[model samples]
Target: SLKIVFNFQAGFGILANMFLLVFYTFIILCYRPKPTDMISCQLTFIHIVLLLTGGNIWLWDIFGSLNIENDFNCKATFYISRVMRSLSICLTCLLSVFQAVTISPSSSFLAKFKYKLKKYMISVFLFIWSFNVSFTSHRIIYSGIFTNVSETKQMKVTKSCSLLSMNYIIRALILTVIISRDVFLVGLMLATSAYMVIILFRHQRQHKHLHNLSHLRASPEKRATQTILLLVVSFVVMYWVNIIISSTAVLLRMYDPVILSVQKFVMNVYPTITPLVQISSDNRITNMLKHIQSLCHHIFKKR
Candidate 1:
């Protein structure tokens, strides 16, 4: 029953995410996503995929049984969900790097590489997909159609299967790579955000800056920078909290289901929260609301 409710909630969440993605795409299409806007669009698209994958898994788990007839569907569902979740995490790291690069100062050598790298975005995205697919194929090896016997027995029966021992060193290497990537991107976000804040502060201190203050204050680029800063801060805080808990659990070799559940919840919640944050702050949505109000008033006058 709880699982069913979770699926329903996830479905609603995915719907909301899709609506936001479309709205943002429209903004990008009409104006077209600048190279910078492309980062947000890609993140939003990945986020939608993550939510849909999760929701489908839950829905199928509740409503679709794992029979031989449905075994392929089950495998496909799990595979796609795992791939999408991993891709979302990977793409988020890319998004941070992309944004940081976009805002890099012209004096910085890094800025010179931006034009060269601009053409590689699609290629990079394709690489991300291929990387995730290669790693997540392990799901196919481990999961299969299960046969359940009399009230208490269930088996992950496999056909002529030889168990391959897990290489702890290899697993550790993969984990280290993921963590290193996250840490690097987080550091970049910190540096870029700090630079932006310092620039704003210095501008505020200039006495001659007063006359142009209103214009500077209303600059879209500044607002966008501030928004990215907020995202970076929230991501760092939440991610570190999870990291601390997760590292402790892994080091201690704690296998308590409750602890595992909490860890999983922490992972899911971040993506769920992001769309809400974006919608709550979207000025374009507010402007659309005002436009709707004006149209209503105009209709009433015509009546």
Candidate 2:
């Protein structure tokens, strides 16, 4: 059941993310590229890579093949996946914060950032990629083929690649840094989410007296903020669930097969649900799908 669940998560997640990535790519190219769309496109690409690496879709099978016979495969898979996961968190946080800033009231301090945020997004992406790569480089040194020794303890990540133990001081320090990073990002997301809620509430109060029905339709900014808030909430929920499963495994010093699989499910949950939520919320995607459907229908009629 665990294996079945994991496979479902991985399969569905990759497909959903691919669907969003293509749509976002088209939007970026054929239309005016919004900052959120660009960030989401990049994030979709990152999730695809994550699904490939950590999603157990290809990495295990590919590395298990005879063509690859070294610890290099293990190091590369864990390191790359780790980097991508870290990047995903950063990008999600960026999206949430960007949306918050996008919707800020004109009189607020956050309003000052609204104009310049889009211009510097690419730079932010580059910096985050570099930072995560460097921060997770330690994974390379600690990941290798699992050697079964009855007397020795190890965290078996896969049939082949496992996490070798690190020095106490080094391990503690790295764990601390990683924890700190997650906490800070999660905190920022919460803060921005709160700010957005306040903004939305005030927006309603300010507009309450007006008889105009025009405000009934959500503006692009409002829609974007609501979508991002949903994503941030989803991300935070999955992150904590995955962290709990992982911490439990680490504390007991044994990665039970069930626990590990649950962790995978938890990790994949966010990526799988994200695109679906975005697709449901975005009218543009709905229109795009409708356009394609009508075009296909017209072609069939002609045939």
Q: Rate the local accuracy (lDDT) of all candidates.
A: 0.62, 0.84
Candidate 2 least-lDDT 10 residues:
55-64
Please report, as a residue range, the 10-residue window in candidate 1 with the lowest summed lDDT.
154-163
Q: For model 1, what is the error of residue 293's alpha carbon versus the real structure, in angstroms, after optimal superposition?
A: 3.7
Best by TM-score: 2
Candidate 1, residues 1-303, lDDT tens digits: the string is 545644655666677678778877888779756565566676677766766654344644544454333556546655776787677656666655665566667887668868766888778878988888997787665444554433122222122111132467866776687677667767776776677677556546774445665555445555656666677677777778778866776565424445544554555565666667666666776688789999999999999
lDDT of 2 by residue, 1-303 (tens): 665666777888899999999999899889998888989998899888888777474555565576684688888888988999999999999999998898887888999998788778778888998999999999999888777774155677665667888899999999899999999999999999999999998887787787475648777777878889999999998888888887898787754777867777777778888888889899999988999999999999999
User: TM-score, each model?
Assistant: 0.72, 0.92
RMSD for all candidates, in order, please: 5.5, 2.3
The CA-based lDDT of model 2 is what?
0.84
Alpha carbon lDDT of residue 104, candidate 2? Answer: 82
